[model samples]
Target: MIYVEGGSFDMGYQRGRDGADNDDVKNAKPLHKVTLHSFYIGKFQVTQEQYYAVMDKDSNSHFKGDRLPVETISWEEAKVFIERINQKTGKKFRLPTEAE
Candidate 1:
């Protein structure tokens, strides 16, 4: 997820509305503006091999491919991966904030 610093742009959906949900009518309405900061992200994803190399265990990740992302990981698992990557890379690679 390599996130480039964001620049201003208009975003829109390709499809038209069917019916708006209540939340959409209330808090989600108006489809307003947003602004955010620049950051880096994983271009593809953290692959199973990349994860297993650091974590040293792959039995839990049943996807069984070097190229595929290891799924079924809980939040704790995600944090461990973040910590390992940060430790190995010496850069604070982390999960993106919801705001981003």
Candidate 2:
């Protein structure tokens, strides 16, 4: 049950091309910034062990153990898992939309 504290962060390419012209989506970007408060996050990606523990069934994830981050999940399904985690821990669990 590792928890990750959240914070505001910038999300964008570290460098823009020298000739990056205007109207380019590269520049068409809005504030690629995400502002969220402190919340718990998985120290590792959701794992088969944890998923089975919470959902009472294996995702049949190929990772084979708790050490691997369970991937191949849809965005909506991930949200559902997060919601369940929040209920169990009494703290919010979510994904990051930015880079620190």
Candidate 3:
């Protein structure tokens, strides 16, 4: 895990050298400020082997590898995994909120 010391940052978008043709940039209009608290985040994506160890089920990813990031998981399944992980490790784990 990496400890990220949080601070205020300007979110949304302002006109840039690269014109506003990108819909993603245009949607982030009317720039706003956002503040966050320090938090820990994984340095790497969770892998298939780790998922299986916690959930007792193989990941459904087509690309098979112990080290590969687990995929084909629905939002609900992810929640279940977090719950199981917390139970086993005695540490709370959760999906990051949008602003995180």
Preferred candidate (lDDT higher): 1 or 2: 1
Quantify all predictions' global Cα lDDT against the true fold: 0.71, 0.64, 0.87
**Per-residue error (Å), model 3, residue 23:** 4.3
lDDT-superior candidate, 2 or 3:
3
Q: Which residue pairs of candidate 1 clash?
A: 1-41, 1-42, 1-43, 2-41, 2-42, 3-41
Runs in model 2 lying further than 4 Å from the true structure: 1-40, 98-100
> Model 1: per-residue lDDT, tens digit, 1-100?
5558875543332225525455444444343456777878777877888888988888276777888888878888889988997899898877876556
For residues 64-88, write the lDDT of model 2, one tens digit per residue.
7676777766778678787887899
- Candidate whose TM-score is highest: 3
Which order, best to worst by TM-score?
Answer: 3, 1, 2
How far out, in Å, is residue 39 in model 1? 1.0
What would the C-alpha RMSD of candidate 3 be, to one decimal place? 2.2
Clashes of each: 6, 1, 0
Q: What's the TM-score of each model vs. the native?
A: 0.68, 0.57, 0.81
Per-residue alpha-carbon lDDT of candidate 3 for residues 27-100, written as tens digits (9 for 90 to 100): 66566898999999989999999999999999898889999999889999999999999999999888987778
Lowest lDDT 10-mer window, candidate 2?
13-22
Clashes of 2: 1
Better of 2 and 3 by TM-score: 3
